[model samples]
Structure formats: C-alpha cells, structure tokens
Target: MKNSKFAWLLSLLLVVALFLAACGGKEEGTKTTTETDKETTPEEEEAAVVDEEQVLNLIMTAEIPTMDSALATDAVGFDLLNNVNEGLYRLNQENVAVPAIAEGEPKVSEDGLVYTFTLRDANWSDGSPVTANDFEFAWKRAMNPDTGSEYGPYMMSGVIKNATEISEGKVEYTELGVKAIDEKTLEVTLEKPIPYFLSLMSFGTFLPQKEEFVTSQGENYAKNSEAVLYNGPFSLTAWDGTGLSWKLVKNDQYWDKDTVKLTEINYDVVKETATRVNLYTNGEKDRTSLDGEYAMQYAADPELLKELETSVFYFKYNQERTGEKTPLANVNIREAISKAFNKQDLVDVVLANGSVPANYLVPKEFSFDENASDFRDVNGDMATFNVEEAQAAWEKGKAELGVTELSIEILGGDTDLSKKMDEYFKSQLETNLPGLTVTLKEVPFNVRLDLDTNQDYEIQVAGWGPDFQDPYTFMNLWLTGGGNNQMSYSNPEYDKLVNSANNELALDPAARWQAMADAEKMLIDQDFGIGPIYQRGLMFLQKPYVKGIVAHPFGGDYSYKWTYIEGKN
Candidate 1:
C-alpha cells in the first residue's frame, strides 16, 4: 500500500512538471512552421519581437488578516510574509533548508547546544544593511509577554534557552539566549539539539525585523505595505490594512535581486468559485483553484494541475467555553461526533478535489523516520467512520448528561465550497444521531480565525499545514496550555509523551519517533481530542505562459522567487 501511495505521488509530481514546462518549445515550433508557409505581415513580425509582460495576476480565497510576523496564524499571512521577508535560511525547490541571510554554515559547539553564524551582506528595502541586531531584536520582541504572540512561545519554547521563561514573564526577554556579537555575526544558544532547527528558521515566526522601522510605526507597524520593511525577493505595495487587493513588486534592494524574474505579482481576494473560474477563463488571472464540480469538470483539462498536500482538516471540539465545561468535554460525546460523519463520502462527493479521508492527525507522505519509513504506514488508521458505533456512543453520552436532545453550533468559512461542506456535515450528524441539533455558522476567513482565537465557537472546522517538516509540528498543538490549543483539551500523559519525544528521547531517534506516534494515537483513539476529517488536495488552473512557481508540502504554499512569464504575447 505504501509503495502504491508513493507511486501516486510520483505521478502527481510528473503532472506538476508538465504544468510548469508550459508545453513551450513544441507549440512555438509548430506555430513558426505554419507561419513560414505564408507571408507574415509587417505588424505581425513587429509583434513577434515584443517581449512578454513580466507580471502575474492571481486569486486568493481569503484576505490577509495581519502582516505582523509575531501575530500571523494563518496561511495567507505566512505566504505573504514569506515573499516579503528574509530569514536566516530558506527552503529550496527540493524543500531542503539552505542559507539565505547567513553566509554559509553555522559553527556548532561540540555539545550541539550553541551555534555561531556569520551573516551575509544583505539590505532591507530602505537601503539600510541587514544586521545581527535585527534578528536579536525580533526574537526578543516576539518572546516578550507584552507582544501576545501565539507562535512565538509555541515555536521557541523548549528549544531556545530561557524562551519559555521569557514568554511566561518569569524572566526578561533580554535573557532569551540570542546575542549580536557584531553587525554581521549572531550567536544562539539552544536548550537542546533540535533536529529540525534549520527548517524552523525558514518559518515566518523567525523572520527578522528592523528595530527602528518597527518602533517608528508604533501601533501602525505592518498594518499596510508602506509600514513594513522588505528584504526578500519581493516588496509588498498598494495594500491597506483590510483591503481585498495587493501587489508585490520585485525588490531591487534584495541581496539576490538579479535572480528574480517576475516584476510584479497582483492578488485579489475572490471567495466565489464562479467568479474565480470566470477570472481564469477570461484571461484576467494567471491561476485559480478549482473546487467541487469544477474539479471534476477540469480533471482532463490540459491546464489543470493537481497536488496532494500535507495539510489536514479536522473538527476541533471545544471542551470548555467561558470557563465552563461544554458537552464536548465528555469523551463519549466527542467520540460519537467523530465517528458519525462519513469522511470517505465527504472527500469523494463533497470535495471531489483529489482529497483523501484522514483518520489520523499526522498526514501520510509528510513525516519520515530515520530509516525513511513513512509515519502513517507504521501507525495505521485510527477512529474511522462507523454509524452504528456512533449511535451507541451518542445514547450513552445523552444518558450520562441526562439530556434527550442537544444542540451545538459549528463555525466554518463562508466560501461557497465551505458552505456546501458545512451543510453536508450538519445533515450527516443530525441524520445519524437522532435528537441532535447541528447549527451552522459560516463567516469570512478572517472572522472565523478571530472566533477560533477567542474560543467563541463550540465546534469548528479547522485545518493546519505544517510550519516545518516534522511530525512534532502537528502533535505539539494539543499540548497542555499550548498557545495553539484553543480547544482546551489536555491530558498529562499525552503531554509527557510529546515532551519526552523532544527532550529525554531527543538523542534516541527510534524512541522519539515512537513517543510521538503514541501521542497521536492517544489524542485520537483514547481521548478524541479532535476528529480527523480529510487530507487536503489542490486542483488548479494555470496559464501556459506561467512557469517556475514552486509548490511546497509545508510552510508557505508556493514560492514565486524563480517564477516567470514566457510564450504569451
């Protein structure tokens, strides 16, 4: 089964290769041969000499909530930050970590707890040189309790020395283990030897910020394109705090500016599928995503591109609301709802976008062991769909709570496809479990994120894409009092298993892997902390002239550094 799954993935990669190739040479050759048989007009000859426009117009499903690296918690913000900011390292086309701002490799201590890096000469968009102090200031700012950054503590705690203490206000942020030895040198001390530290450096949370620029803005920092500084391949422009449109122009001040191909990239938030498809079909946009029936309709289209992603969607059961335990706090109730929905049908019929039903938190083809074995295959599936079992559990839960009927509201996105999926879930739950009422509350993407952060909903359809390539990224979210644990689910044993995997078992590769696997099973099979839905798959359309857009299974979805325009007139 694993071999076949990998074969499927390889075929998808081949399709991606063809999509990026854009079928350029052969079509141009044939066109030239046909034109040779006839006399070409002077205007036609002149048109042939003109260069194609080096611009890319694209569509986004959601609006970017914030540009602040310390506060971003969604994909849109991360993707935007990824293009406009520079970090110590960046993931290459092959998803391997490579130095970006750092000169080369860091000199590591023999004990593997300290690293000293020599910074390369790079400049921000304003012509000031990027310095080691920028990194130190940014890291300390994020770790400061006053910043209220969820990712800061969640990502750096247990890894960086004194980070946990600084976030908890037990120590000052100045003592957070990062120091600027010189303008071009930075020294960092870690609590332990982290296996994925390089990959983590490429994430948005670790991106640098200029202290003067950020402080000058005061409350306005990163509120708009003009307020933020850029040091990456592109610089954001024409963006207001809450606008639906923005543009990214090539950053001339970037260290490797010569390698950038696209001069401008424009984006507009489009929520409806019909509008997105119309924009693509009318040649107003270079790319658009397909959903539901559109995905099936374009399955054989030459412009269609499909990729199975590493992200997974699930039902987050909020165990507590307003300091009171909710019905979802009961293990039986959570388990009943988890097993009530038909995930296979949800993917095949409702989604129809190459997605697969997911029974576990960690996705397949994502994380691997030291021996190159896929983690999903080793752990297998857990808590799959069973209507009869769901019914039995629901009765028991109702009896325990002394209730004949129960009502709960689920919060989800207001996108056209999202509404359809929400309606289907409501129908399935209400139909399978008698005397149960499911209410749907659909809001815009940004609004939904706010609600999730406030824990204002009873149940929410949430999704997570890995910030880095590791099983721990998915497993760590449910830790006791974790920043991302908005659902209020906690288990001491689960915490012990996850902490040990990253601490005492850090040197033991096999044992660490086992501990993480055990934690995932415990979260799903035993506690029913969250219900797994489906592994995401993307099907989209791209113009033949567009090329070199690199898609990653983790972190920011696509990188446009090497993307370019070609054959189109």
Candidate 2:
C-alpha cells in the first residue's frame, strides 16, 4: 500500500474540484440566514438589548485563549466566538444554516457569480449598528496576511471569489470576494457556486467585527472581557484574559433579548477528567465531560446521553519539518507504523464508554452514497493488522531504506487513556517491527493542537470534526492547498476525485456520492501519513431541566444557546 501523491496531481484535481463546486445549477435553496441577520429599514428603530443588567454562569471543560475571532481556531476559540460575536447566518439545531445577521437567504444573481445580502439592524455590544462593512473589514483583515490569522483560509479561500488568490499574494486584498453595497447591505461573488457556503458562515472564524473597535483596541481588543463586544444572547461578566473560569450573563442589548431567559452562566475551564467529573458529582459544577468508568454509572442515573460522530483521534506526520520528518517521507515506513496498532482494542479497553474505535477516513454517519456501500470494498484496508504482515512490511521497508533499529517519537495527550494508547502503540510497533525503538510523549490537549498547527512534532496525535455536512470536510484535508493537510500526503488521482465532487455541487446526487467515496478509498487504501483509529460517536447528557436545546447533526450547535432551563430566569 502506498500513499497517493497529491502535490503532483493538484493541477488536475484543483481544476476538477473547481468544476464540482460550480457544477450544480443555481440553488434557490441554500439555508436562510437567521432573523438577526435580516435586512432592516430605517423605520425599524427599536433599540436592541445592548446593556444587560443580569448575568449568567457557564461551566466548561476548556478555557478560551483568544478573544479575537480571527486568531481563535479551536474548541476554546469557538466557544468564545459563539458567545461574543454573531455571523451573518447561524447553524440551527438541525445543523441547517439559518439567518443570523442577514435579512434572508442571500439573493443570488442569475449568473451565479453575485450574492446580495440585506443586513439586520443589529447593534454590537458597544451600541454601534452592525453593518455590511463590519463584515467587509473582517474579511479584508482576515486575508491581510499581516494579521497573522491562521483561520483566514477557513474563512474565505474555497467559496468566495478571489479569496484564495488574495490570501496567496496572487491578488490585492481589496479584490477579495466580498463588498459593501451600502451601510446596510453586502454583496459576495463566488468564483464557483458552493453548496456548503451558508453552512461555512456558521463557523466562528466568520464572525463579524467592528473596524473602529478593532483598530482602537489594537492588540488590546479581545484581550479581556471588557475589551470585546457582544452580539449573542450573553456577555462575559467576570473574565479577564487570565481567568481560569468566567461567566456569561444575559445581554439586554441583544436583538432577541426578550427570548433569552438564563440569567447567569458560570464557566470553569477544567482540563482534567477526574477533576471535571468530580466537580459535576460534588455539585461544584453544573455540566462537565464524564471520564472513563464514570460514564456508565452516570448513564444509569437516567440522564440521556448526547453524542456527535466526529471523525477520529489521529496522528499526523509533518513531512516538511526538515530534520524531524525524513522517515515520514518514506511511504512504506509510514505504512509499517499504520499497520502496527489495533486502536479498536485500545478504545474498548481504555475508553470503555461512548467513544468508539474509528477505522474510516470519513465517519460513516456523514456521507449519502446509494451505491456507496459497494465502493472498493470498505472492509479492505492496509491498516488491518496481522503481526506477520506488519513484520513483513517493516522488514521490507527497513531493508529498502537500509535502516536498523530506528528511533521514532510520537506525541499525544496526558489523559489516562492516551497514556495507555501511547504505550499500546509503542509496544505494537517495537514488537512487530524488528529492531525498532519507540518513544511516547504526552502533552495537554490544547498544547497538542498548538504543536500540530506549528507542525512542531514528527509524529503527533490529532483529530478533526466536520465543520459542515459536506464530504469535502474530510477530503479537503488532503488537498494540496488545504490548511489541515500538514502530513504532505499527496496523490493526483485522489485529488482529482475530490475536485470532481466539488465541481458537480448539488447536482447528480449519485455521481457526487461516488466521487467522495472514490476519494476516501484512494486515500485510505494507501495506508500512510494517517492511520484510521475509529469513527467518532456522539455522547453527552443534559439535565431534564433543560429544553429546546438544538441537536442538529449539521446545525449551529445550540447546546449553549437554544436550551431552556425550566423555572430558571
């Protein structure tokens, strides 16, 4: 099994992906923006709740690192943005795109190149009206290159016209895909029509910002609770940039202020599972992630379990790190490592709860293939380990490369399960691959992601959940130009398949499914750069007191917003 070479095949696949993105006939049917995102007339002068007197409390397992939407890129970043800012559209509980700051679904021009937005007369937490240029400023700033924003591509590059060009220094920043029609309206031109456009807006990276606020505060903006603006239902009450915990209180100035009932939300950022579960049981915290062995006991107590099929826990090989990445350059050696572990057994023994062992490139629950069950035999994978097969591969690989007793380093989290998995991976590789030496290192969860983005480690553990419902979410990671594709795994045919799917857009459902399926198989069949661990299982629990919480597979994710607490204000 060999990895596909995407960097070489990108020219062809990029063209195909472009065609798929523009292939579908005009969609008069994209998700509509939420009420807050709608267009407003001057006569609608009702002042939104901008100065709330009441505060809410929220307890979370993580702490937010940055308040600046452009700079934030992880769970903490998203939590911060979802609470403090608003997008033109929001993902609903059903994971469908709905209006937020826009008046309605974007008005697509007959040519399919232009999109017009009617703005909602919403105000920022600072009492300034949110206008089209607020978005304009944000978009331009995102692509400015000098902003040091890691999330810019996640924002404009794929869907918006000229976005990729501007970000790549191929065009002027002013020429990027968006423009302000007036103070109340915005226009967007996509180089290609994208089915996933509206859904992409729901992400925190696309949240709006006020130009004056941004420039005035400079680096100080989003540095603390008082430095940021609020457009969502709540505002931070007791957080500085340094707090281990914070609070979210109702914002009286919010557009839908009347509907918000939870008066105060207390948040505590607990990274340790034992500490988190203990807080929940000791009544020190209202909500938390249950640790191993505790999940079963808590489940029998009658609380419903909530789960999301996020992709997998994975290790990425950074091929571009000069001295730290040569072994990763050898596909056979990489394949030997992939064949050396049985992650399913690890999950069964270590996870022992909601998390499942993943072996697929894309989560099974995500795709929509009619013949998809028949593509290239899903059961066939190089990752299926036999000690003999592993040894054979390792022996052949080492002989060809002329290496003896190699030293390899792997990084993961400090979790008890992670520690065991690290040990398991080490033992499997050392035993199966003769004369091989392995080293296991554990870091914090957030620190792992940080290292991943920096491509700082040789073999580092990581995972990615879908940003939207499209198969592109998984496939995009392999694209030569993709941000998450840090492994340097490349294949021309695989890239061609992904590009073909994008070109077709929302048309020819059968062909679309097949394209994504073909791409997944090609990548997985190669068995290097990535090892399939398990399809993620969604699992969580809520108090009976909470209601109306949106649990859409693709929605804006309403566990924090749409849920209502009975008898609480």
Candidate 1 global lDDT? 0.79
Off by over 4 Å in 1: 1-50
Model 2 scores worst on lDDT over the 10 consecutive residues at 1-10
lDDT of 1 by residue, 174-251 (tens): 898899999999999987665456556776777899999999999999999999999999999999989999999999
- Using TM-score, give the best candidate's number: 1
lDDT of 2: 0.62
User: lDDT score, residue 151, model 1?
Assistant: 75
Give the runs in model 2 whose Cα sits over 4 Å from its true position: 1-59, 370-382, 415-417, 504-508, 552-558, 567-569
lDDT of 2 by residue, 1-569 (tens): 00000001111122222211100000011112333335444233122222322223335544566777777655555644665567888655444567889878888888776879898878887788998998888878877888877666554676678877876789987888789989988998887655445655666667788888889998798888988888887787678887788877777777877666566777876666677766666655555545356655565544435454444556676666644545767777777777777766666655555555655666554443455453224433436666676677778778877887688789887766577668888887788788888888798766776777666777876666545444565677777756677666778888787766766533666676677777776666564657777544433444434334444332122335654454222
Distance from true location, Cα of 41 in model 1, Å: 32
**Model 1 per-residue lDDT at 227:** 94
Mind sharing the TM-score for model 1? Answer: 0.91
The number of residue pairs in model 1 that clash at the backbone is 0
Clashes of each: 0, 62
Q: Give the TM-score of candidate 2.
A: 0.84
